[model samples]
Target: MHLFSAVPRGVLTLLFASLLLSLADAHSYFIVTSPTQGTQLQNGAANRITWIKGLLDDIDAFDVEMSRLSVDGLILVARDVPAGSGSFNLFLQDVPSADDYYLLFLNSTSGVMFTTSSRFSIGDSSSNATATEPDSSAPTVTISGGPNPLNDFATTFPPSANGVAMPGWKAIEGSKGQLIGLFTAMMLCMAGGAFTLL
Candidate 1:
């Protein structure tokens, strides 16, 4: 009398396979870790930008952008940053002093904004102040409900001087290594269950 008992065995197997394939196609994203809310970065100083990547596949690189809350456009910070490198060293020399600066990470291949960092302030180069650590407990500022931020701004901002690739910073093995291992273990368990049922 079970509903699934009425379905053919091959049809049930096809349905299960389809479900697994859909799960494997999940989209990837990045989470900015450093320069969180209320962090004060000094101009003309080298600051490390770090992020945690989630299930990166298909996208090979990212374009970093900076925008000010008071200004009306975006600034290109870096281009073609490798997807696997979880950290970038940014040297802010020519950037103007602004208290509402935030960073945007875009997918280079797709031109889509993947994530944005919490707002951080940049001080004047002449100031004798050092950059402060990010206040972890501060609430993040979210930017939304506007025209595509990239539409008005041209790629005029020169790339930052330091592009030091820290590939080992929080490395997550090969891009697809973890996913492949997961699929293999799942299939083995499914096959074992099938044999037991038979």
Candidate 2:
């Protein structure tokens, strides 16, 4: 019997399954820890952003995108946060001017989505918020991953291998691009073996 024909069907099945798992999409459970939703933050006051695991499985390194937008949709501040593991504490410095509301977004490397929490203007005065001291018990917002499989979340780019917190982004549906890539690889592998048999 030829070597290719002699190969068991179960062996081929196992190989396919392995490939599926490797290409299987991964997700993260992101949540906001500090500054509960709907809470008011004073201008120029330092507020800490709290988040759970922010890394997506396919992400190579940790990177965070922070943005502060005005009520008129003006961008006040935007930058990258250094990547790390587990729980993360992010600082909001140089707060926006005369802004009624602002949103914070976070993402993880292995995560397929981005989580967000918003804080509205606290007062009308132009006084600056004290730096360094963050109100620990100021009604922290808690974010968690959904138990349902069809989790709809927005994903951030340049995934952090061990990112703790990411900026706020809306959830989106799974990517067709990734699924198509997996199937194409399977077909190529199968064709290679068939040509050898001939």
Candidate 3:
């Protein structure tokens, strides 16, 4: 009457152990401390490249390097922080001659996951570059008879909240014309089936 009764007791024990290992290995989340993405900083500003790492159960320590990709390999290494410190800090002074540079965390034994987020800049002027954000103010419009409205919004607006297909795409989603068209199409299909049967 038990659910895993047909399985061998040893096999069940092994499965439970495997599940525990996977849970430990699969836990990680990183967040930048300061000078957020696409932020403009002083020429010699030693911005602390600190990041909050979530779930540090497995990984004790790892090296963090601020690097930029080159034609051959990582070229501009502003800072390379070695492991083994109670508290760790990464700092960068001179802005790389290059444009896009990112932080790379390398932990072979434990937590080596790196951030693939868009490159942040350190420059004199950030007037032209705008920080990307989602539009959270608008009250979304919904089609009562169709699929969910939030899904429709996501399919239309991107994460940057830029370049929607049409300004009225959300507002006009529940318009009578659209509903009538869908209703009419369904009725016509039903009628065609009835005529064939007759």
Candidate 4:
């Protein structure tokens, strides 16, 4: 009997399950917000930030902060606020000058945090937004409680001898291109002995 065929049906089933799991999607690690992405904000506008409920399975209630739009880590647009029930509003009392700002969401329980993909402008201030030297005295945001291995969160795991990915490989749903590539590979693998004689 061929070695592949001799493999027990139960083992094959386990292999299939593992393969399926590797294809499963991972957690959405962003602060879901109400402001249309890239929308210019009005001075003193109503900014609504929401927690992505059920993300990471058990985490909820995060502390939110807005960075004063700088690549270097020294500027906060606003102090941190609690997002209870996964939603909260930001009232710009002083009416910040129109400019791009990055939002940070830190999980209160785990200290896990995710930042906005890019800076979002406050009102129609992009053209008027001027670059200023980042203040050396500004507080730097310290990130903590990241994944066991930060690379593992964004990278797909290698296939094991049985052609199944190491336990927790999952595709990030936000990345459409990578997802398509993964799907293509998934199909090709099934056809190419990854599941031979299945």
Model 3, 39-82: lDDT tens per residue?
54334323334455554433334444344454223322222232
Worst 10 residues of 1 by lDDT: 138-147
Better of 1 and 4 by lDDT: 1
Best by lDDT: 1
**lDDT per residue, candidate 1, 86-179, as tens digits?**
6656656656776898988886456788889999987766876676433343322222222244543322233433444437634445445566
Off by over 4 Å in 4: 1-31, 71-84, 108-111, 115-118, 124-198
Where is the poorest 10-residue window by lDDT in model 4?
A: 151-160
> Per-residue CA lDDT of candidate 2, range 1-198, in tens?
555566566676667667665655445445555456455554434455555543553323333333345333223122233333322332333433433444444333344335555554443225554333455543222222212234322222233334444444322223344556667677857865674556
Which candidate has the highest TM-score of all? 1
* lDDT (C-alpha, whole model) for all candidates: 0.64, 0.43, 0.41, 0.45
Residue 17 displacement in candidate 1 (angstroms): 13
Candidate 2 residue 9 Cα shift, in angstroms, is 19
- Comparing candidate 2 with candidate 3, which one achieves the higher TM-score? 3
- Of the pair 1 and 3, which is ahead by TM-score? 1
State how far residue 58 of model 1 sits from its true place (Å).
2.0
What does each candidate score in C-alpha RMSD? 10.1, 14.3, 23.0, 15.4
